[model samples]
Target: MMQTFLDLKAKQPEDLPSIIKIAFGLAAFFPPVKSEIRLDFFDDQLNEVQKEAVSFALEATDLALIHGPPGTGKTQTLIEIIRQLAARDLKILVCGPSNISVDNIADKLGPFRIPMVRIGHPARLLPSVISTSLDVAIKYSSGGMLVNDIRKEMDEKLNTSKKTRNGTERRKLWEDIRDLRKECKVRERRCTEDIVRASKVVLSTLHGAGGRDIIRQNFDVVIIDEAGQALEAQSLIPLVRGPSKCILAGDHLQLPPTIPRTDKTSSLRKLELSLFERIIKLHGPLIKRTLSVQYRMHEMIMKYPSIGLYDSLLLADVSVRSHLLSDLPNVIKTDETQEPLVFWDTNPHGGFGEDDTGAHESKSNAMEAALCRYHLRNLLEAGVQPKDIAIITPYNAQVALLSGLIKSEFPDEFSEIEIGSVDGFQGREKEAILLSLVRSNEKKEVGFLADERRLNGICLLQNSHFLGTVP
Candidate 1:
């Protein structure tokens, strides 16, 4: 996969520089339509900022960046843009770094009644969107009835062969069954190709797009969600499929592409800076537009990232600022003012230890895990739904420790509550969050705890509290 990316990069028109130049050009690539752009498909009106980005995307010929911070309605904006592009009779390739991200966009597009197909492992996708799976694509494109008929014949022959007593008849039945199965395989491939060629919108993970069935396909526009979390090479894989315009939506300040530690100075590691990060750093926002209005975080939760990371560019929407956990239990609040943020100091003495995987993972603090259980019980007792609370930590070992602790102690309490590492918790949210900052040591030699991006993941919540520290 890395070699394919390198080969594609080498063959790229001007090694990405030329593409950037073409993408950033102000020339109007999309011809003006006879009628003005209308966003009737949206249930609600697009905010002014969102509307501007849509207009820019429709008019721009080259590359475009939709700087969607958490809760900024990035997926909604992309859906709108996709509809408008389709209205122009253009094909779109919607892709992302991971299956989860791609499935999310595909899921949202599901409601729009669009002609789309999601190409990847069906198990990774939601059942609602699985109808657009590659299998379904083949069925639809090649005629579902034909595929079903072939499958039905194969099934009938197998059942008959099972019932057959005569060796000669049974052998003949198995041969017919094998032929039918072969025919089914042949039809499936043809149907898949047909769907790929006919799809107005194609959804796929970056790697999934490299399939031979789609190699010859190109698109009028390409939209990549969560671009910041994708390695540069992974991002290039889908873009190689013909896309005249590219739309990248993600917050680069939150999480970066995951690079293997062993490849620290390797050529592969150097490509760790995501395409979104590279563009924004080099271009300095000339080709990017920050989606300033975020509706996810409370005023307090949005504070750190807004001022420290986003240059105070982020503003909590009115609804978000006004939202309060009115039913929050007194035990969870840090003060009488009822502010949801808390920094529960366990002052644990535990330090880092190498796990079986040999990674230096943070040792779980018993005090912190116990406190988390206490808080979760209090929240539930106060009428908070189990699903509304999320327990976030910075280490997988800590996640395991906390999860085990929760199950053993509470048994059935807050079973829906999520407990995972910060990286796994990206692109997710909860009404109230209980973060276990598991680093408790007298020396305060923070390991991955010092990473600002991982810390930013903490800020992605709506109303949250952090307990414990490296004291």
Candidate 2:
């Protein structure tokens, strides 16, 4: 696939999308298709940005980009577009950076009874979609002799029953389908090329699309969700598998690709710029439609990000901002009397150090971890739901430390608290968030802590009571 992409790049295809334009420096310009397209399958009224995205997706032949801020209904828009495409008998391939994202779309569209298959290890997929798993496709798509026999028998029975309108004959045909379904379940562990060939839509991770058995297949359109988190090389794996008509939906401002190496000055960091971010930078904001109405955060909590990151484009949807928590008496002290954002200026007392994996990771500070526990205890004692609070840090070490501290300090209440790194906590929301900035040291070195996207991540999550530490 990499060789194919390189070869295509060398040729400089004339109809590639904006991302390909930035990648290969192609000068070809294909104007957006002006023919009007409408969707009778979807009934909901779309916002202006969503309507533009749907129009661009249907009109453009090469690619379309959707800039989805937090709570902007990216998934819903993607699902509607998929419905319109499927209605036209297009073969679509849906992909993402993780199985969760792929499964999410699959789950959303599965109830529509589209001929879709979620291609991944069965153990990793949601159980509700098991019938659409790759295993079921492999089990039922082959064994030509037996399959032909069953089809021939069904046809014979249907022909004979058409004259008599016999219920007994129809009952037998139904029995054959039930047996075939059972056979698919019995052979759930086997996988074959027939899976991708039989499916009208295949959903998988970026690397999962490169399976050796299904490499030769072609799709009419490919849609990649969470495109900002995928490496440029990773995104090409799916893009090269088919023609270049594609849709990339993600927020570049929230989280970029995670590069684990600590060599900040090395040229290898160039790979961290995702294909989504690269195209957005080259083409500017006009190339993609931004979903501006945010439904996740309170008006007060939405102020910082709207001003700093989104150029004040985000407007708080009042209907969704009705859920607010009662303010704590003295736990949060700010210049304004009722501000929900709290910044704890903790002293720097820790630094980055080597982990067991021989890589330098963020060091955990006992003071900050203890402070997290203190706030969590107060929130719970004040009648806040344990599940409504989240503890986030940029470092894996701090996640482990804070998780352990929470469990030990409040064993009975530990099960409900969600603790994880900021990357793991993306696409999730909480009523009260406690952020432990793990970098603390006398040298004033902040070590991978200066990226503004982390702050953007905070804006992505829900807001009512937010407690953050600054070193």
Clashing residue pairs in all predictions, respectively, total 2, 1
Using lDDT as the measure, the top candidate is: 2
lDDT of 1 by residue, 1-471 (tens): 564556665664554533444433422233323236464545366798888777766766667788988888888888899988888889999889888898888888887777888898778888888998987666555366688999898888899989989999999998998888898878777777778778899998888767766676877788888999987777777666446788888888887888765534466656667888877776666677778888886777788888988899888888777565654454333341255566655653342222233334345666666777887776666667777778878776778888998888767763787888788888887877887776665565566668798788777854543333333
Global lDDT scores for all candidate models? 0.73, 0.74
- Candidate 2 ranges beyond 4 A from true positions: 1-23, 29-45, 140-195, 241-244, 262-265, 327-339, 348-359
Best by TM-score: 1
TM-score of each: 0.84, 0.80
